[model samples]
Target: MRTLKAGALYFVLVFGAGFVLGSIRVPFLVPRLGARFAELLEMPVMLAVVFMAARYVIRRYALADRRTRLLMGTIALVLLASAELLLAFLMTGASPSAYVASRDPVSGSAFLAMLVLFAVLPALLPSGAVSDNPFKPKSVGGSDSFKR
Candidate 1:
């Protein structure tokens, strides 16, 4: 349930952001910078949103473990990627391979790197400094409830 909640929240944040960013990119950036650079520009925005949203979910839901955070983040990424590809196909009527091949080399590589970082960040960023259990009161020793 917690994973689902976090995943849903992540999806909402990323997808909502993509919608807004896409509006800007398609009209303004794409023409000037081309499709690749426009997408590269959007990468940072998406990463920032993902970082903030994941942290918010972690703190708000008290998701302490790396596993849970990773799971939620992965689920979010899969959904985001799927939606993005689907949108590309529908909007341009381009086959997946054709679309991939069309990406500018530099920007395409950068985007791939960003995707890797997105998968790794959630697990790496969150520290297990807090406990998820509500009944166990936090002690001076921190996450180790028995230490006190």
Candidate 2:
């Protein structure tokens, strides 16, 4: 339930943030940076929101399960990248030369570095951090507790 709420919050934040940024930049940044930059910025924000959620999940439950967290993060990054690629096709009909060129060309390390940053930030919450879980487990009729 916390994850769902966090995801919903993430979606809303990213959606509204996109609109707000778009509206402000429609006449300026959008033209200078092109639709691609605006889009690239938006997707990262959404992914960050998701990462925030995942971080919360990790800290709140003390899951401490790196595999699950890493998988969740990798999935988010791939989805974001796919969305960016698809949006590139839709907006410009071709990928910008600058898009790939702007990064460090040393074995594609910079591009992969950004990917890693997004993939890992969510799991960097301070040790022993905790989140308030409103929908946490509750005791049933017997002594067993049901996980929400």
What TM-score does candidate 2 get on C-alpha atoms?
Answer: 0.48
lDDT tens per residue, model 2, 1-148: 4443433443344345445665676677668876556545555554565455656555554544455445545555565566556655686666645455553354245346656666665455444334355256433465444545
Q: Candidate 1 lDDT, tens digit per residue, 1-148? A: 9887887787778688879998989999999988877888789888898777666677667877889888887887787778878888999988888888887898889877876676667688738533465346556656576655
Q: What are the lDDT scores of the predictions, listed in order?
A: 0.78, 0.53
> Considering summed lDDT, which 10 consecutive residues are worst modelled in model 2?
2-11
lDDT of 2: 0.53
Candidate 2 residue-wise lDDT at 95: 68
